[model samples]
Target chain A: MFMFNSLVENNLKIISKLKKSLARPDLGAITGTILVFLFFILVARDTGMFSLEGTMNWGIVSSQFIIIAVGACLLMIAGEFDLSVGSMIGFAGIVIAVTSVVWGWPIWLSIIIAFILSMLLGALIGFIVIKTNLPSFIVSLAFLYILRGLTIFGSIHSTQKTIIGGINEVSKGDWLAPLFGGKIFTGLFTWFAEQGWIDVFEFGTRAGQPIVDGIPMMIVWAVVLVIFAHFLLNYTRFGNWIFASGGDAKAARYVGVPVDKIKILMFVFTAFCATVFATCQVIEFGSASADRGVLKEFEAIISVVIGGALLTGGYGSVIGATFGAIIFGVVQQGLFFIGVESSLFRVFLGIILLLSVIFNAHIRKIIIGKG
Target chain B: METPIMQLTDIGKHFCSIKALSNVSIKIIQGECHCLLGDNGAGKSTFIKIMSGVHQPTSGQIYFSGEMTTIESPRSAIDSGIATVYQDLAMIPLMSVMRNFWLGRELVKNIGPFKIMDTKKCNAILMQEMEKMGISLHDPSQSVGTLSGGEKQSVAIARAVYFGAKVLILDEPTSALGVYQTEKVLKTIAKVREKGIAVVFISHNVNHALEVGDKFTVLCRGKTLGTAVRGKIDYAQLQYMMSGEKLN
Candidate 1:
C-alpha cells in the first residue's frame, strides 16, 4: 500500500510539472498545430496520398508562409497589424527582378537593394503610425494598396509589361541559386531548389541536404526567427515593454516603457519578414509579378490566429504561428490530394478560423474561472 | 513628531471645467500606513493620480521627504521611490508571475549585441521576495490570470517592495476581495509598513482603514475633511467626517 501510494505521488508530481510547462499561451497553439498535422496525415492516408515525397513538397512550399507567420505573430503580440505584407512581397520580388534583368545588376546587389527598400518601406509605415497614433490596420491597408499600385505601375513603366519572367531560368544558371536550391544525393529526394546547399564543418557537413539529410534552409530560417522571437518575448527588456504596451498602453506609459518605439519596431519587422519571404519565393519560382504574393497577408494573419495569438494584443508565440502556418500548408496540400475543390478549401479555412475564435473564448473562460 | 516622508500641500487639479481635486493637503510619514477615506466622486482617484504623477496639479507643490518638488510624470514618481498599485493592478493576466513582478524592470544579461532576460535570476528573486513576505506561491511560472484576487494584490505589493518603493500608494487593494482575502491584503499592507515603506491606503471601508492605518485623512466633495492621528479619533469620528457630518 505504501509503495502504491508512493507511485501515485510520483505520477501526480510528473503531471503537475507537465501542467506548469504547458501553461504557456503558446502551448495551446502548438498542441492545436500537432492535431492539425495529425488530421492531415489521416486524410492523406485515407486518400492513398501519404508519402515522404508529398511531405517534402508541402514543407518546401510552406516554408515561406512559416517564415512570414513568425513576424506576423510578433506584430500581433505588439498589438498591431501590418496589412501590406502581401504587397510588400510583390514589391520586393519586383525590385529583385528589375535590378537583375533591367539594370543588369548582380544577383547579390539586387538582393541587397531589394532588402533595403523593403525595410525602408516598413520603417516609413511604422513612422507614420507612431506619429499620428492611427490604427495600424488602416495605415497598413492603405500602404498595401499604395505598394500594390506601385508594383503594377513599376512593371508597366520598366518592362512595359506586368509579368516578369526569366527569374526561374536565371535562378537555374546562377551559382548562388544552386547553393540555395540544389539537389542532394542525385535523386534520392528532390530538395527545395533554394535549400539544398552544403555547409562545411570540422566533422562533416553541419547543414545537410534540404530534403534527405535534414531540415530545409527555409525551415532553418523559420526556426531561427522563432528562437529569436521567443527570446525577445520571454527574456528581453524590449519584449516586456512590447507586452506592457499591448496589454495596456496607459499602464506601459505609466511604467516608462517607450511604447511608441516598440510599436514602430514591430511594424518594420513585419515588412522585413515579408521581404525575406519574397526573396525565397523569387528564388524558388524564378519569376516576379504584381500578383506574386496575392492575399498573403490573409494567410499570415490566419496562421497567427490559428497559432493561438490574441488579436487584441499583448499575447502571441512565434513557434505557435509557425506551426499554424504549417497547419495551413498541410490543409492546403492535403485537400488537393483528397480531390477537394480549391473553393472548398477556402470554406474549410473559414470554418477553422471561426472555430479557433470559439476555442480562444472557451480557453479564456476557463483561465478566468480558474484564476 | 518628525517630518513626513511625503507631503502634499494645497494640491489642486482641474479637468477642463470640473474641479476634481481642490486644495487637497496630506502627509505620509515613513513606516506609517496613511488612510485616505472618501466616497465615490470625492476625488480619491484624482488625488492619488496627482500623488503618483499621473496628472500635474493645477496649482500647488508636492514635497517628497520634505523638499518641494515637481512630479511631471509617472517616471518621475517612480524615480522618487513612489509606486502606485491601483485596483486593477496594471498586470498582464497571461504573463507569468515572475514576468509580472519584473514587467518594466526586467533583469537582463548581455550577450554580445543581444540582451537576454535572466529568467533564473528573476525566478530566484521572485521566490525569495514572496517567501520573505510569508506568501507561498505554488508556481512562479503560472500565469497571473490563474491567481486568486488576494494573491494578485500580494504580487503587486511584493513587486513594488522589490523595486525599492519608499512610498506605496494602494487604491482599494481589498475592495474586490472576500472577508478572508481582505484580511490577507491588510496583512500585506502591514508587511509593507514593516519594511519601513510609507503606505497610502485609499478606501471607503473605514474598518479596514482603521485596522492598518496610523494616520487618517477624509475627503468629501473634492475637499479635505480633516487629517487626524489614528489613536486620536475613533471609528465614529472617521465615519462622521467621511459622510459630510461636521465634527464639533
Candidate 2:
C-alpha cells in the first residue's frame, strides 16, 4: 500500500510539473484545439459517418487556411490586423493568371512577378496604415472592399471570363504543382482488405501523388513561413522590437524601439502571406476569380482570436494561431461529413467562433489577471 | 564631499495654462542618495520627468558633470548616462526576467544585419548582477510577473546600472512594497550608491526617504520649499515643508 501510494504521488508530481511547464500564453489555444479535434472525431463516429478519405480531404482544404492563419496570427500578435488578406489572395491569383496566360510569360517569371506585386502591395498598405494613424481594422477593411472591386472589374474586363485547364500542360511540366500538392496515399482500404477489426481505420501509405500534390503544398509554405516568423519574433532584435511596439507603442517609443518600422513590417508581411496563399489556390484550381477568397478576412481574424491572442495587442503565438486554423478546418469538414445542413454548419461555426472569443477572453483574464 | 555629478539650475516647466515646475534647483553628488519629498501634485513628478527627459524644461538648463545641456527626450537622457526607474518600472510582465532586464538595450552579438540577442551571455550576466546585488533569485529564466514588487524594482535598477547609468533616478521604488520588501529595495539602492552612482529617490514616505537619503529636497505646489543635508533636517521638518507648511 505504501509503495502504491508513493507511485501515485510520483505520478501526481510529474503531472504537476508538466502543467507548470505548459502554462504558456499559447498553451490554452493549442490544448483547446486538440480537445475540439478529439470531440470532432467522436461526433463523426457517433454519427456513423467517419472515414479516412474524408479526413484526408479535410486536411487538403485546411492547408491553405493554416498558412494564411499563421500570417494573420503574426500580425495579430504584433497588435494589428490585415483585412485585405482575402482580397490580396484574389489579386495575386489574377496577377499570376494575367502574366502567365495573357502576357505569354514563363511560369517562373509570372510567379516572380506575382510575388513582387504582392510584396509591393503589402508595403503600400503598411505605409498607409503607419502614416495615417488609423486603426488597422478600418484601413484593411477599406482595402478589402477596394481590392475586391478592382479584382472583379479586372477579371470582367479581361479577354476571358475563366482561364480553364491546368498550367502544367502548357509548360514543360513544371515541378511547382508537385511541390504544392504531392500526395502520399494509395487506394481505399475496405473491410476485406484490412483482414479484421472492422477496418476501422486505414492509414495513408502512399509516398507522393499529383493533383494538389496530395499533401497540399500550402502546408509546406505555412510551415516555412511559421518558422521564419518564429525566428523573427523570438531571435531577432527587430522581432523583439515588434513585440515591444505592439505591447505598448508609447512605452516602446520611450524605450527607443522603432515603432513605425515594426508596424510597417507587420502590415507588409500580412499581405505577402495572403499573396502566397492565393498563389497556392490559383495553382491548385488552375483558375482565378474575383470571388476566390471571399470572407477570408473574417476567417483569419477568427483564427487569431480562437488561437488565444489578445486583441488589445502585446500577446500571441504563431503556433497557437495554426492550431486555431486546424480547429476551424475540422469543424468545417466534420459538419459536412456529419450530413448537417450547410446553414446549420454556419450556425455551428458561429457558435464555435463565439465560444472561442469567450474562451480567449476568459483565458486572457486568467493569464493577465483582469488587465 | 565629492563634487555633484548632476546639477539643476533654476529648472522650470509649464503645461500651456499651468506651471508644473517653477525655478526648482537641486544638486546630486556622486555616491549620495538625494531624496525628493512632496505631497501629491507638488511638482515632484514634473521635476523628475524633466530630469529624466520625459519633458523638456520650459526655462533654465541642466549641468551634468559641469556641462550645460538640454535633454530633448528620454532617449537623450539615457544616452547622457541618466536612467529613470519609473513607478511602473516600464517592464513587460509576460517576458522573462533576463529579457526585461535587457529590453531596448539588449546585448547583441552583432550590431546589425546578423545581430542577435546574446541569450547565454545575458542570462549569465543577469545572474551575476542579481547575485552581486545580494538578491536571491531562484531562476533568471522565471517571468518577471512571478517576482515580488521589490524584486522587479531591483531588476529595473540593476538593468540601468548595468547599462552604465551614472545618475540613477528611482521614482518611488518602495512605494508598493511591504516592510521587508521595502528593506530589500533600500539595500539594493545602497548597493547602487556603492558603485559610485548618484541616485535621485522620489517618494511620498518621509521615513523611507530618510533611511537612505544623503540629502533631502522638499517641494510644494511646483516650488522648492528648501534643501537640506541629511543631518541638518528631521522627518517632521521635511514633512512640514512637503505639506506647504512653514517650519518653525
Candidate 3:
C-alpha cells in the first residue's frame, strides 16, 4: 500500500510538470504539427513525398506562408491586424514589373522602390488607424480595396495587359535578383551527388547533375524571418512594449510606453513582409499578375491562428506560427501526392482552422484559470 | 517649514458645457501619504487626470518641487517623476511579473547595433526589489494575472517606486482588495513613506484612509471641501466629508 502511494505521488508530480509546460501559447500548434507529420509519413511513405525533391517542393510552399505568418503574428500580438497584406503583395509585384520591365530600371532599383512604396503605404494605414481611432480591421480593409484597385490601375496603365513577363529574362545576371529568385549551396549538392548521396540526372546535357541543386532564396528568407522574429519577440525590449500595448494601451501609456509608435512600426513590418513575398513570387514565376495574391491575407491570419496566437492580442508565438506554415505546406502537398483532389485542401483548411480556434480558446481559459 | 513636493492651485477643468472640477487646490509633501476622499462623481478622476497630464485643466497652475511647470503630456509627467497607479494598475495580465514591472522602461543590453532585453538581469533586479520592498515573490516569471489583487497592487506600487516616482498617485488601490489584502497594501504605503516618497492615496473608504493617511483633502461636487491633518480631524468628520456633506 505504501509502494502504491509513492507511485501515485510520482505520477501526480509528472502531471503537474506537464500542466506547467502546457500553459505555453503554442501547445496546440506543436501538437498539430506532430500529428500532421505523423499522418503524412504513414500515408505518403511510398509516394516519394519525403524524398529530397518532394520535401523541397512543399518546403517552398511552406516558406511562402512562413514569411507572411511572421509579420501577421507580430502585428496580432501588438493588437492590430493588416488585412491589406494580400493587396500589398499584388501592388508591390506590379511596382517591380512596371519599374524594371516597363520603365527599363535596374532590378535592384525596382526592388528598393517597391519596398519603399509599400512601407509608406503601410505607414499611411497605421497613421489613419491611430488618428481616426477606427479599428485596424476597418482601416486595413479599406486599404485592401485601395491597394488592389491601384494595382489593377497600374497594370492596365503600363503593361496594357494583366500579366507582365520577362522578369526571368531581365533579372538574369542582376546581382540583386538572385537574392530573391536564385538558390544557394549548389557546390555542396554537387559534392553530395558525386558521393552517390543524392539523386542525379543521368541523361542528355544535364547528365550527372544533382537533381536538388540548392535551397531557394525564398526558403532562406522564411527561415531567417522565423529566427529573427523569434529572437525579437523573446529577447527584445520592443517585444515587451508590444505585449503592453496590446494588453492595455491606456495602462501602457500611463507607464510611459509609446504604444502608438510601436503599433505603427508593426504595420510597416507587415508591409515589408508582403513586399518580400512579392519579390520572391515575381522571381519564381518570372512574371507579375494582378490576381497573384488574392485571399493571401486570410491565409496568413489562419496560419497565425493555427500557430496559437490569440486574435484578441497580447499573446502569441513565432515558432508556433512557423509550424502552422509548415502544416499548410505539408497538408497541401500531401493531398496532391496521395492522388486526392487538391480542392479538398480548402475543406481541410476550414476544419483545421475551426479546430485551432477551439483549441486556442481552451488554452486562453487555462491561462486565465490560473488567476 | 519644508516645501511641498507638488502643489496645485485653483485648478478647474471644463468638458464642453460641463464643469468637472472647479477651484480645486491641493498640496502633496515629501514622505507623506495624502488621502483624497470624495464620493462618486465628485471630480476625483478629473482632478487626477489634470495633475497627471492626461487632461489639461482649463484654469490652473501646477507647481512641482516649488517651481511652476507645465506637464504637456504623460511622458513629460513621468519625466517629472510623477507616476500614477490607477485602479487598472497599468499591468499586462499575460506578461511575467518582471516583464510587467519593466514594461515601458525595459532593461536592455547592447549587441552590436541591436539592443536586446536583459532577461537575466531583469529577473534578478525584480527579485531583489520585491524582496527589498517586503513583497514576497517566489518567481519573477509568474504571470501578473495569477497574482492576488493585493499582490498586483503591490507590483504596481513597487514598479512606481523603483522607477523613481517622487509623487505616487494611487486610485482606489484597496477598494478591490479583501480586508487582509487592504492591510497589506496599507503596509506597502507605510513602506513607501519611509523612503521619503510623497503618495496620493485616493479612496472613498474612510477607515482605510484613516489608517495610512497623514493629511486628508476632501472634494465635493467639483470643489474642495477642506483639507486637514490626520490627528487634527477625527474619523467622524472625515467620514461626513466623504459622504459629500458640508460642515458649516
lDDT of candidate 1 over A1-371, digit per residue (tens): 99999999999889767655544555666787678677877667866445545766677666778878878888888888999999999999998888887778777677778888988888899889888889989999999999999999998899998878777655555755443344434443334424444222235463443334444556556667778887887668888888777777766776678888888888788887887787766776677887777889989998888777788887767777877788788778878888888788799889888987666665554444351
- Taking all chains together, the TM-score of candidate 2 against the true structure is 0.83
Best by DockQ: 3
Off by more than 4 A, model 3? A1-16
Error of 2 at A340 (Å): 3.4
CAPRI band for model 3: medium
What are the Cα lDDT values of the candidates?
A: 0.81, 0.77, 0.90
Ranking by DockQ: 3, 1, 2
What docking tier does model 1 reach? medium
Comparing only chain B with the true structure, the TM-scores of all models are: 0.97, 0.95, 0.97
Off by over 4 Å in 2: A1-19, A36-56, A98-114, A127-132, A157-216, A369-371, B108-118, B178-180, B245-248
lDDT of 2 by residue, B1-248 (tens): 55678999898889997999888999989999999999989998999989988888999889989888888889999998999987674676656677678778887887576778888998899999999988888667666666778888988888889889999999988888899999999999999999999999999999999999998988898988768888889978888788798655
Report the alpha-carbon TM-score of model 1 versus the true structure.
Answer: 0.86
User: How well does candidate 2 score on lDDT at residue A160?
Assistant: 48
> Could you tell me which residue pairs clash in candidate 2?
A180-A217, A181-A212, A181-A213, A181-A214, A182-A213, A182-A214, A183-A209, A183-A213, A183-A214, A184-A206
